[model samples]
Target: MKTKLFSALATMVAPTAMTVGSVSADAVAPQTSKADFSVVAKDPTNPTDPENGTLVLKSVPSFSFGTIEASEIYAGFTGKVAKTAGALEIADIRLGKSDWSLTADMAQFTDDANKLTGAILNLDSTGSLGETLTGAVKDDSPAVEVVKGNGKHGVDNFKMEAATLTLAANPAADLAKDESFTTTINWNLSSTTPTAPTA
Candidate 1:
């Protein structure tokens, strides 16, 4: 009876089994990838891979005065003025200034050794965006302000025409033959209205 009573007391006093081993665990945090962003101004010659907010000189025309006859030269030839060829197209975004102006040099036709003696280029831009020109001008002269606009800052085209052409009498009196001449038209752009350069 004593043994049975001691066993009952020990069972009531003993505690339950417990686990104390180390537990393996790991934690995770959330984050995002980072990189630098920017835009750079570049020449617009090629538009294949253009990025956003890019400005480019899209297209321009090559003016050509076709073959002239001796009879026409004697009477002073005049060629047709048309924009059948491409016009000047400028592709701009809102990144450019709200206003812009264009300046171009009045080019003179000349060959390797001789200039067209009395040839004239009349740019009659009276009602157009360009300046009206009615006289002969030097090639190396200061660029002439041709076009100006206000409050328009985006892609657009400008038409160019040759109002008239007067050829000089043949000084050499030689038989009529093919003659080719080229002139460089230097173009300038400005954000503000450009004043005509003083002589």
Candidate 2:
């Protein structure tokens, strides 16, 4: 009996002694991973429309100078095209590469009668927008730089204030009754320094 009791006590105490030994739980971390990302600009809706969620250049409105009496001596007339601030807005949303600019064509005004040569439109460079129109440009010549865009996304907003077109008149030009004159002023937006568009 004494031997059996001792054996039972030993069996019970054996588990307690085994628990005194060190028992370890390991801690580990999984390997890291990465994900790639990219973006694409949306296409323009129409020739006259601005693109969605991307860079877009809108067509400029036609400028009209009311009828003026002709003179034998050289004369000059100036017409305001965009007087209100923020009238001209360029929308851009490119990521990382956000440099852009604008160019306007210097052109001669033409009458339907094929007369009035040497009449040119002049754009003033100094004005409210920190010399926005610095120099004059004409058609058939290199385009005039309009804007050195601020590198940004939607945060960048630009407009021209007090922009005008001056018409230089020559006396020898032939006259026409109710004569109409028209010229196309092309505007281009580029990611780099701009050149005039091809005729």
Candidate 3:
């Protein structure tokens, strides 16, 4: 009976070994492929009946006067025709002003520099009421003169006086169409030496 039992167990183990030996092995091929595409389009056209947009414009006119490039200070001396009181002052000055005309040129639009124009004058401590200062462009022969004094005084110890630039509509009117603009003026001052004052 023991030998029959041992024989049955050996038969069971043999079937298990045979099943393990029947395992299968295989190899898979790698996939290799590429994809391609292209794009084609056009911009949309504006509507024929377009709405008019509002344009608000603003600007400030300011100018700067440079220092006295050339100046002459004379003390009291005798040869002069008449005796002058205290010290005498002689000043020669030059100045400039620039109008920054900013325009929002949209959708094939343009604004020319000729549309905007102005003048600036140089002022000093000695600027008298109703004094007229002149300026000119380097290439242009036309010179612009600005008048001083509208009852305004200097702010501090500098003794600088207030002045105004009278701009015409024909020259600078077109710049008013933009949202904002600015005008900057610069000036120079100079003078020659004077004869010594006499006692």
Candidate 4:
């Protein structure tokens, strides 16, 4: 009976041991296997060549004032005109004082002087604000002066002070009969520079 029991135990153990050895052999085979790789030559030209093209940079600066007109007027009379009874007509008034303001476009250029020299300034027009008297003066008259303000620069930007307009008498206009005066105000960017304010 002991001999028969020993024989049955050996048969069961032998098959279980063989199954474990088969799994172990499969795992060891992966460790001994060799992996193959390859290397190729690099292309002579850059991959991003077409996308990395050349670029050109240009600087354009310009400035202009708002459409200005005679908003208010105050006239004074002298010697003989003071004794007149009735008020003077708007057309006939002489030696009158007028006040007007221009809604200035200050953000056209980073520098005032550069904007004036780079482009022409016109009144209420977009294309080359030319120095033309839109109201009652000729085109060639030198009746305007380009006034510049104190320049202030912050970071990468700069601004100029308010440009004041002065109207001088036209040389060709009639002095005696024609009491009307007209002039053009040009914001010249050619003379813009950073400076301290005057008291």
Candidate 5:
């Protein structure tokens, strides 16, 4: 009887088994991919891909002043402006105030024979989220910086309105009748390297 009572007491006092190994979880840095930039188009309908974290110059506007009459061609004569032809778009996948610069320059208007002498192109911006990108681009000089900085905090998609193009210079001579001329407006973008935030 005494032995049975001792056994029961020992069984009641037995210890429970336990596992003692360590368990852990880990995290890694985020990977960012960029989307290829599309050709500049007026009234761009391309969607921003924040998922790809694209920090790029998405598109720039292609303006049309339409056909001009030789008699009416003069300084400050901006021909019949096409509707919604000057919306420049940017794609940003960034942290904090991401700095960027957009520059523009123009080529001389050319006919089949020669350049249209003394003609200048001026871009007038009506809307901008940050810095206004309005400037004149002469064929003789380097591109002018139109806008600098996002004019906002953090990453975002932005639209810079380039409202109209004014013919700032008069041709030295009268344009030949029925002559059509073409020119190019070159655009460039600059991105500053970002620094990580610290506590």
Candidate 6:
């Protein structure tokens, strides 16, 4: 009986084949994420447009320059697009990135007849939320730097109370009668925040 009791005690005291197991957790593939930015379309000018990929380029101002008369020495015209007329708008929702900017480049003014020779459009813009966006698009010489994340988040929309477009047409350029002179101001959205151009 004593021997049996001793055997039982020893068996109970013996460490049961100790085995250690480790637990761990890992991050999934694709690691971090990214976002896509875009310049909002001029036409339709819809901020809530479902087609705006990643919800970028939400909206922009539309300039409605009334009528222009032909001139021989060159004539100048100006148009205003106020915030009421869809002020410049942009939206960004990117991950792992926040720095962004916008630039403007005006294409040549054209119509059904031909290009408006020696014609140029000068763009003057400003931000509503106190952003320095004073820039222009002179003959496509590096799209004028419009705005960046200057002390504001990339997603922080910088609306403008007003924007000015000055149109100077060539003098005596065979003024087409009742012809519609049209042009495009390409608004580019970029990832890097470029330096706000001097003057």
By lDDT, the best candidate is 5
Best by TM-score: 5
Question: RMSD to native for every prediction?
Answer: 37.0, 35.6, 44.9, 45.2, 28.3, 28.5
Choose 3 or 6, whichever is better by lDDT.
6
Model 2 stretches astray by more than 4 angstroms: 1-53, 72-74, 77-86, 115-134, 155-161, 192-199
| lDDT for each candidate structure | 0.35, 0.35, 0.17, 0.16, 0.39, 0.36
Q: Which stretches of candidate 3 lie over 4 Å from their true place?
A: 1-114, 117-161, 171-184, 191-199
Model 2 C-alpha lDDT versus the unseen true structure: 0.35
- Give a tens-digit lDDT track for model 4, residues 1-199: 0000000000000000000000001111110101111111111101111111111001111222222121111111111101111110001011122111111121111111111111112222111212211222113333332221122111111121121122222222112211222112221122211111223
TM-score of each: 0.51, 0.54, 0.21, 0.15, 0.57, 0.56
- lDDT tens digits by residue: candidate 6, 103-131: 65554554444454333334455554456
Residue range 104-159, candidate 3, lDDT tens digits? 10011112333222221222233332333323221112323222223322211112
Flag the better candidate by TM-score, 1 or 3. Answer: 1
Model 2: per-residue lDDT, tens digit, 15-126?
Answer: 0000000111111111111111111111111133333344554323222332244441135345524232222344455445546666655344444443333433344433
Where does model 1 exceed 4 Å of error? Answer: 1-54, 70-83, 117-119, 124-140, 161-176, 192-199
Task: Report model 2's TM-score to 2 decimal places.
Answer: 0.54
List ranges where model 5 is wrong by over 4 Å.
1-52, 74-82, 126-128, 151-162, 168-177, 194-199
Candidate 1 on 40-120: residue-level lDDT in tens?
Answer: 111111123223353334444344443344444334444434323445544445344435555544344443444434444
lDDT tens per residue, model 5, 120-172: 44556533455565676665468788766644533333333344444444445
